[model samples]
Target: MANVNDKYAIRMMKADDYEQAFVLWNGLEGLGLSEADSPERIARFLQRNEGLSFVCEYEGSLIGTIMAGHDSRRGFLYHLGVATAHRGQGIAPLLVNEALSALLREGIDKCHLFVMEHNEAGQRFWSANGWEKRDGILLYSRGLESRGLE
Candidate 1:
């Protein structure tokens, strides 16, 4: 563990960062981690959606991470997390803003992120940041491969 007072920098997440970043996300309670998060898949994601993902480095240790990307018209955010000891110091918003900023630069106007229904902390974070929870909307997804991608 490194001191928060130490030098810190936020930069794009490289492929090599997959292992450590995966560990960090899995350690967090609310994040849904799965085998699909393997390094190969993450690398493919970063390759297609570069510059929208980032990690926070403190004394060479990864202390935070966020992933944002857009599908031409709208942006989506995911896996925004900061270390337990790093909360309440304004790092989370910084990470979210950076990702959102990147998406904005990509010509995306509207953005959305999914928070588990039970993730009160995440809801508060978004709400406090002026994000309104949409009413009567739902997020649905399915595996492309299951539909015949593979």
Candidate 2:
């Protein structure tokens, strides 16, 4: 909740928020967005993880966002970003706290997030916020072809 006199508010993110959130994320450095972030995909994500994602609004404009979801065991967070002008105003953490709190309410006990190897600022932010970095863990990925495994 924002103070009555403040110009900012925090709330759960809705599907309609995708456009604004995409613009904010695309403009931010160290954020790696791809086709996976398409509007349809984001909308689907919000539906599957309802009430777990959040956004921050300031003066009627979106200034921050955090997307969260879970696999019935561990929660994962993504796309956390704050407008450049809104940095240092504690908006990022507020968005994060909102997502984390929602995850907790869903009975998620542990959480994880990824930072690009080159994103120094992002790494620092997570470290400063009490998130531990896991060492010796490798992440692997594979892309499925449209007609594979038929």
- For this target, which candidate reaches the highest TM-score against the unseen true structure? 2
Prediction 2 global C-alpha lDDT: 0.91
Question: Scored by Cα lDDT, where does model 1 land?
Answer: 0.83
Any runs in candidate 2 off by more than 4 Å, and if so which? 1-5
The numbered model that scores best in lDDT is 2
TM per candidate comes to 0.89, 0.95
Q: Candidate 2 has what TM-score?
A: 0.95
Against the reference, the lDDT scores of all candidates come to 0.83, 0.91
lDDT of 2 by residue, 1-150 (tens): 542237878888899998899999989999999989999999999999999999889888988899999999999999999999988888888888888989999999999999999999999999999999999999998777675766
Residue pairs with clashing backbones, model 1: none
The digit string of per-residue lDDT tens for model 1 on 67-140 reads: 88788988999889898877887778778878888998999999999888888888888999999999998777
